[model samples]
Target: MTAGQVSNNGPKPLQRNLSRRVSFNEATLARSQEPPKPPAEPEFIDTEAQVVSRPPYSACCNSCCAWTSLVLAVLLLLSILVGGVYFAFLQSNLPQVRLHRLDVYYLEVNNTDTDTFLTSDLEVRLNFTNDNSKIKLSYSRMTASLTAEGVDLGTVTVPAITQEPSSSADVRARTWMRKTSAEEAVAEDLRDNSLKHLMVIDVVLKGHIDFLVNGNKMNGFPIKVSCRSIDQSEIDNGHAPKCGVQMTPL
Candidate 1:
């Protein structure tokens, strides 16, 4: 063929080859830039042979937890039982005190001047009863005071005594009152015509009562005894008066 015709045919084959190579490179670049088709989602299969993961804690840890729970349950049960017993036995039964006999006497009376000191003596016979069938009561010490019209008198002390369950103990104390100004005032008030027929006195007792249960002693609890509005006529007639007692704090 001629030189021009050969050049034309050669260029046509070369151009075709170049066009095919460019198309292939463009397709490859487009596929790469399209995020690689999202990496093809994995297929899910349902089978019995599939594995299940367990918790990180081993069997030993599970056993420890169970034992801890059991111990706590046992402790709670014991606490409830002990509380029930205490309520039924110890808490329900309380001690009582009663005034069995009381007497008052006036001594060294002077209607004239010289301060007119008044002295009095009181005989207090108290019955201490323990109503509990299982617990024993111990009254370690006791001290009592007499008062009239807000004036404090001397104190009376009683020795220690222990009372068995369902038993009673007798407590005897002799209290005296001797004051100068207050005694004169009290005597004057008592001797008044209107009040002479209706005279009253106040008595206060302070002490500690301890409880013994199953060889254990629970003590340090305070007790207060208040005897107020004690009619002198009733005491003179040999009739015991009523009073109230309470458990108090230190």
Candidate 2:
């Protein structure tokens, strides 16, 4: 080989090396030109948790409601029992009162031009019966009003009385009225009835009564006895008519 000329084999090796270096540089430049990749994000996992909670006063409220219901039920039961006992006692232990006889002694009516005057004398008898086995009854003063043919004659007062169980009592009342003003028509009717001996009188008695259970005084109740159309002839003929009795709450 000449000194000035390069050998072909040596040059060929150099060329090969330069080509490899050039290919590696091209690959690095291509990687640089591409866009940069973002950082990897952390993986996320979804999880569900179950929790149990209760109100602060739930147990206390439940207990209070239970006690309240129990108390109300007990009170209701007691009231029912007491009411039933009271009703039963009242039904079985009430006293009975009746009007036995009514006697009219003198009845006179005088009439003027436009006015009328009446004079009368009457007697009333009442019979009171207590059928209770263990109760006693006491009565207040009784007032009796007499009416003849729709004319108010007079009113009489009877004394108070007391009756034991299974016992009876009789009361008598007398009334004398003189020169009482009356309606003309009513006075005429009374005069005619009195002359024919067919006069009828209505007697209404009002009073109050109290019951004693084992010597304990109970509440007082009002009593009313009504004797309607009491015939004077029937009383004179030894016949007694029964009257209606009513007992009411005070």
Candidate 2 lDDT trough over 10 residues, lowest sum:
46-55
Worst 10 residues of 1 by lDDT: 190-199
Model 2, 1-250: lDDT tens digits are: 7754666456888899999999999999999999999979976644332223334467889999999999999999999999889866775566665666766678788888877888888788878888887988888968888887788878888899999999999988788989888887787788788777688888888888788888689856777778898887887687777777667542
Give the residue spans of candidate 2 off by over 4 A. Answer: 1-81, 84-88
Q: Please name the candidate that would achieve the greatest TM-score relative to the true structure.
A: 2
> What TM value does model 1 have?
0.56
User: What Cα-based lDDT does every candidate model obtain?
Assistant: 0.71, 0.80
Against the true structure, what is each candidate's TM-score?
Answer: 0.56, 0.64
Candidate 1, residues 37-108, lDDT tens digits: the string is 557778876554453444458899999999999999999999999977964554455567666665555533
